[model samples]
Target chain A: MLKCNNINVKNILCDVSFEVKRGSFTSIIGKNGSGKTTLANCIASQRKYGGSISLGNTSMLDISPCDRARIMAYLPQSLPSPNISVYDLVTLGRSPHTSLGAKLNKSDIESIDNALAVTGMTMLSNRMVPSLSGGEKQRAFLAMTLAQNTDILLLDEPTAHMDMHVAAEFTELLNRLGKTLIVIMHDLSLAIKYADNVLILDSGKQIFFGSKKDLLVTDTIEKNFNVRKIENDGEIIFTV
Target chain B: MKKLIIIFTPLLCISIILGCAFGSADIMQLIGNDTDTALIIILNLRLPRVIAAVLCGIGLSVSGVLLQCVTGNTLAAPNIIGVNSGAGFCCIVMLTFFPKASVLLQIGAFAGAFITTLVIVGIASHINAFRGTVILAGIAITAVLNACISFLSLLDSDVLTAYNAFSVGGLAGIRMSQLYVPAIIITGCLLCSLILSRRIQLLCLGDAIAASLGVSISKLRIACIILASASAAAVVSFAGLLGFVGLVVPHMARRISGERTSKLLITSSMIGAILVILADLFGRIILAPTEIPVGIIMALIGAPFFFILLFKRRGDNAEM
Candidate 1:
C-alpha cells in the first residue's frame, strides 16, 4: 500500500490523504492549480510532505532510492529536449535497476523491448527524441516508464493537453495495464470512463473520494467543482 | 557499444600518431637525428601541443557533456560555471607573476579550477539542490573572468605574447611529457565520471524527476561539478582555452548516437579527437611554412555551426 496522511503541500497540494491500494486503478481529477501534480510528487517522494507517507509497510523516507525506484515509476508531465535518440531515452528508465557502472544485460534489453512493444514505439526506437511529435513523445515517455516495470505509477496530467482521440485511447491503455495507478487528470469524462476509483481535489483538499460512480453523478461535481450537470451515463460529460 | 569503441580506438591511435608526428621537421629528418633543433622542437614544442590538444579535447568535451547532463541544459559547459575562466585567470596570474615557470603554472591553474569549483559548488548547489546557485554564479563570473583575462592580458603583454600561441589552442609543440601528467589526471577522473554516468542521466531529467527515480540529486550534482571542473582544469593547464570543441562536439555525438552517457563519453571523446586532429592538420597545411593555432580555425568553423544549431534547437525546444 502507498499511504499519505495529513499531507500539506505549498503552492500546490495541501492536507490531502489517500491510500493507493495495491493493483487498483485510481484517478485523481481536479481543475488547474488544484495541487494534483503536487500530490503526485509527494506520493512519489519527489517532494517532502508535512505528515507521513509510507510505501508498503515502511516510511518512504526510510527506503533507499534504488528500492523506491523499484516500487514506483513516475512520468513527468513535461518532456525535456532529447539531445539523443528514442532508444537512449527508453534506456534511461533502466537506470534505477542497475548499480553504478553496471552494463545493460539481456534482461534489461528484454525489458526495453517489452516497453516498446506495449507503447507501440518499436518502429520509432532508432529515431532521435527531439524529432518526434508531441503525442509520439508521450508514447516514448510512456515506454520509458513502462521499461521500469514498477508496481506503482504516478502520472501528472497524463493526457491534459492531448486531443480527444488520443486522450480516449490512452485512457483505455492505462485502464488495461495491471498496476497501481494514481494519475492526475483534467478530463472528468475520461476519468469516469477509465478510473476504478475517483478523487476530486480542489485547492489541495480531498473534496470527494469514492467509486467512479459518485464522481460521474451530478451532485459531487456540483458541490466540489461548482458545476451543475454531467450526463448520467457510463462516460460522464461535465457541463458548465 | 563495447565493440564500437574497440573499432574506433585503433583508428584514433593512428590519427593521434599522425597528429603528433607533423611538425617543423620532416618525418625522415626526425628519424635520422634525435638531437637536432627540429627534433627538439618536435619533442618539446609540437608534441606537447598535440598531446595537450588531445588531452584538452577529451577533457573539455567530457566536462561539457557532463555539465549538460547535470544541468539538463544543453547550454551547460565548463564556461557556464566560470571554471574555464578560473583556469585561464590562474594561468594569467602564474604567467604574469612567474614567467618561465611551467610546473608552477600547471599547479596554479589546477588550483584555480579547484578553488572555483569549490566556491561555485558551495554557493550555488548545496549538498541538496541540484544547480540553481552554480548556474547563477556561473553567469555572473563569466563576465567577470572575461574582463579580468582581457585586463591582465593587456597589462602583461610579454606574458600575453608568449602565451598567445597557447591561447590559440593548437597541438603545435605538445610533447608526450608535457601532457602525459594531465592526461593521467583526466583519465582517472573519466573513470569517476563513468561510475556516475547513469546517475547523471537520471539527473538530466531535472531534480524532481531524479528524485522520483530514486536518485540523490544534490550528491550527483556536486560530484559532476567537481569532475567537470577537474576535466576543464586538466585541458586548460596545457592547451589554454580551446573553444567550440567542448561546446559543440558532444551535441554532434549525441545527435549521431543517443544520450547514454556511457555511449556519449567515449563517442564525444572520439569526436573531439577527430575534430582536433583535423583542425591541427588544417593548421599544418593551410599556412604550412608558419602554422596557425588549431584553436583559431576551430572557432572560425565551430562558432557558426554552434549558433545555427542553437538557433534551430531554440525553435525545436521552444515549447519546453
Candidate 2:
C-alpha cells in the first residue's frame, strides 16, 4: 500500500491525504490548476513536500533512487522524441537493475520483448522514436515504462497527445495490466468507467476519496468540476 | 559501426604518415641522411605537430559530444559555445603577463573555459531559454571574449606574433615538449568520458526521464562540463584554439555510430584525429610554402556545414 498523509506543497497542495491499495487502479481527477501534477511530482520524489508518504512500512523519501525506480515508475506528460531506436529506448528501462558495464542478459532482453509485445509495439521496435507519430510515440514511451517492470506506475496525463479512440484503447490496456496505478486524468467519463477508486482534488484540497461506486452517487465531483454526471442505457457520461 | 571504425582507422594512419612526412622541409627524405638538422626537423618539429593534431582532435570532439548530450542542443560545441574563445583569451593573457610561467597556462585555460561554460549555461537556464537560445547566448558570449582577446593583443605589440599565430590556430611550430602534459590530460579525460558514456546517454532523454531512471541529472551534467572544460582547455593550451573539430566530427560520428554514446565517443575520437591531421596536411600543401592555418581551412568547411545544418533543421525542434 502507498499512503500519503496530509501531503502539502506550500501554497500548491494543502493537507491532502489518501491511501492507495496495492494492485488497485486509482484515478486522480481535478480541474485545471488543481495541483494534480504537483501531487504526482511529490509522490515521484521529484519535488519537495511536507508530511509523509510511505510505501508499506518504509517512507518513500528514505528509499534510494535506484530502489525507488525499481519499485515505482513515473512518466511525465510531456515526452521527448529522442533520436534512438525503440528497442534502445526500452533497454534504458533496465538501467536501475544493471551495472555500468554489464551487457543485457536473458532476463533483461525478455523484459524488453515483453514490454514491446504488451504495448503492441513489437513490430516497430527497430524504428526511430523521432519518426513515430504522436500516439505511437506515447506507446513507445509507455513500453519503456512497462519494461521497468515496477509495482506501481504514476502517470501524469499520459494520454495528452493521443486522440480519443487511441486514448480509450490505451486506458483499457492500462486497466488490464493489473498493476497499482495512480493516474492524473482529465477525462471524466474515462476516469469514472475504468478506475476502481477515485480521488477528487478541488483547489489543492482532497474533496473526496472512495470507491468508484460511492463516488458516482455523491455530488462532490459535480460541485467541484461543474459537471453533471448522467446514466443512460447503463452508460455513464459527464456533461458540462 | 564496425565498418566506420575500420575505414577510419586506416585513413587516420595514412593521414598521420602524410602529416609527418611532407611538411615544408620534406622530413621523409631525411630518414637515412643522418644530418643533425634533418633529425631535429623530423623528430622535434614534424612529429610533435602530428601528435598535437591527434590530441587536439580527440579532446575537442569528446568535449563537443559531451556538451551536446548534456545540453540537449545539437549546436553546443566547444568552439560554438565560447569555450575555445574563453580559453584562448586566458592563454593570451598568461603568455603576455607571465611569459616565464608557461607551465601554468593549462590551469588558467581550464579556469577560463569552466567559468565561460557555467556562465553561458547559467544565463540560459535562468531565463528558461529553449535549446536554440542557448546557442545564441553562447555566440554572444564568444563575441565578448573575442573582443577582450583583441584588446589585449592591441595593448601589447610583443603579444602580436604569438597572438596572430595562435588566433588562427595552426600546428606549424609545435614542439614535442608542448605535447606531453596535454596528451596526458586528453587521454585521461577521454577514458573517463568513455567509461561514463552510458549515464551520459541517459541525459539526452531529458532531466525528468533520466532522473526517474535513477541518474542524478545535475551531478552528471556538472561532471560532464568539468570533463569537457578540461579537455578543451588542454587543447587550447597547446593547439591554440583550434575550432570545428568539436563541432563537426561528432555529427559525422553520429551518422556512422548511431545514437549510442559509447560508440559515438570511440568513432568520434578516431574521426576527429583523422580530420585534424588531414586538415593540417592540406594547410601545409594547399599554398605550398605559404602555409595557411588549419583553423582557416576548418572555418572554410565548417561555416558552410553550420549554415546547412541551421537551414535544414529550421522546422525541427533544433531550430527553435
Point to the candidate with the largest TM-score.
2
Per-residue lDDT of model 2, residues A100-208, tens digit only: 7678899999999999999999999999988998888888988898888899999988888788898899899999888999999999888888888999888898989
Chain B: TM-scores of all predictions:
0.86, 0.86
Off by over 4 Å in 2: A228-233, B26-43, B80-82, B102-107, B114-151, B317-320
Alpha-carbon interface RMSD for all candidates, in angstroms: 1.7, 1.2
Backbone clash count, each prediction separately: 16, 0
Give the alpha carbon lDDT tens digit for every residue of B147-207 in model 2. Answer: 8888888878878676777777878778888788889989998999987887888888877
Leading candidate by DockQ: 1
* Candidate 1 per-residue C-alpha lDDT over B252-292 given as tens digits, one digit per residue, 9 for 90 to 100: 77765577787888888877877787687677867677887
Error of 1 at A85 (Å): 4.1
- Model 2's DockQ score: 0.58
- Candidate 1 lDDT, A98-187, residue by residue in tens: 778888999999999999988889999988777887788888888888888899888888786689899888878877778888888877
DockQ of all predictions against the true structure, Cα-based:
0.60, 0.58
Model 2 chain A: weakest 10-residue lDDT segment is A216-225
Native-referenced Cα lDDT, model 1? 0.78
